[model samples]
Target: MLAPESTRALFTGHSLGGTLSPMLALTLAGLGALKGEGLVYITVGASPGNKGFANIFAQTFPTSTSTCPETGYAVWSKNIINSRDIIPQAWCMKRILSPAQNVKNIPSIYGVPTIPFIEFVVFWLNANANKSHIMYAPLPITSCWASSLRRPLKTWLSFWVSHWGITMHFITMCWV
Candidate 1:
């Protein structure tokens, strides 16, 4: 819907798409095709990005703001996470799973000898943070869902039913 529109653009997605929508906005704004002030992004169950990407993204467009009646930020995007959903709260260790290969941290750039500051920083933090996933969230990230404990079997059955039956992005969940 954004292709032909002249007004500023907005996009949305679910799950992994949560990460993508804001990325699209960043790309568009970088190209000067979209106005940063007019752009907005709403994502559901979004995952986190690397620290480098987060820093670059934040530098490009500030995160959402409060003080506005709308759930949207006064500036950037908004993320929504379900109360019972563990997707947003997921933890990972990228380095242990896949340590850096036999390659230099920052290769020479035409012999000028420059360090990839952002990349190195991300790698350093990733290694130290156990390479766990990183993410950003808005205040009060949940909606009206209340806490309720279900039996072990019941929880599994309902999760699988709602996941496979309803076609939720539960592949990652199944991994757990």
Candidate 2:
């Protein structure tokens, strides 16, 4: 049992775990197991949820600079996203298709003709799984975009690296 006044919870996760962390935090907060002011969640590469859930979560744990009596800091959550990473943009129809569309617009540098196929797959997935009305709206927390270099090759490499490895390392280093 936790005394809300004294107990501070910091929930942190990457990728799919990122998607779950805030949900868990919200559950705990709703159950009166933790106080909103004392709860903080930091997530990277988090998958998107429906706008309604995002709104409720944001209302439950709003981002504030005001100090908490217990922790002396009152940032309820931080969503760190890599700009080039597609994971964070998923599950939302418009967002899921935007990257694919962007790729389709780009001329194939290597003449490989792979972008069309990739676009087809993305469209298929979005059509099958994404709900039109359930758009993604991120929590009203302090969010940061860790953007990679703009060049094509570098962007591609950095996207994979940031999503798979560097983002976690950077977060870990911040704590250490």
Candidate 3:
């Protein structure tokens, strides 16, 4: 994990590492690294073997804690996952354990509630604002479902066939 004042990009490994990257991004943003024009991207791999990571992330710096370094600045953050990646499976399990649990802090404005994650993620993806904030890359590189989207596609059929000892890329597509 990068220090609160570091200028480096904060990335994490699969599973818990992936979860940590975004939390750190939020922390840095709260401290002001992404003020109106900063960028942060977290690419999570596959690691669902650990638990309690998300809780630690959510409660890391509670609202009651001291203000972050850039409390006044806005930051841009994104989460990317491969469509066939099993690491996200762990995230799904985590969610099941805690449903409807607010993932991010919601600020009160004129008595209205604000969801920062939605605002940054869902909205940004819908707009494709210059580039997608989160990219879901489908697997097999060539299947009905894989070719169905407008995302970039590459030919990994041979690799997939050799990797899983299967003739079709369909199976691996699920983990892409």
Top-lDDT structure, candidate number: 2
In angstroms, the error of model 2 at 71 is 20
Q: How do the predictions measure up, each by TM-score? A: 0.49, 0.60, 0.28
Residue 46's C-alpha lDDT in candidate 1? Answer: 46
Question: Can you tell me which runs of candidate 1 are displaced by over 4 Å?
Answer: 1-6, 36-38, 65-76, 91-145, 150-153, 164-176
Candidate 2 TM-score, C-alpha based: 0.60
Steric clash pairs (candidate 1): none
Write down the RMSD of candidate 1 (Cα, Å). 14.6
Ranking by TM-score: 2, 1, 3
| Residues 45-143, model 1: lDDT tens digits | 444454455455666655556466464333345455444453443322332321221112222211223335524633554354443344332212333
- lDDT digits (tens) for residues 1-176 of candidate 3: 43344444533433456555555655665675644433333444332223344333334322221234243122123234433332332222223343321111112111133335324533332343224232222110111111222221222233334555532353344334
Off by over 4 Å in 3: 1-17, 33-36, 45-76, 94-176
Clashing pairs in 3: 31-69, 31-70, 32-70, 84-174, 84-175, 84-176, 85-175
C-alpha RMSD between model 3 and the true structure: 16.7
For candidate 2, list the clashing residue pairs, or say none. none
User: Candidate 3, residue 18: CA error in Å?
Assistant: 2.9
| Runs in model 2 lying further than 4 Å from the true structure | 65-76, 95-114, 131-137, 140-176
Cα lDDT tens digits for candidate 2, 31-110? 88884344545555354565677777777766655455344223456565544445555444553433432222323322
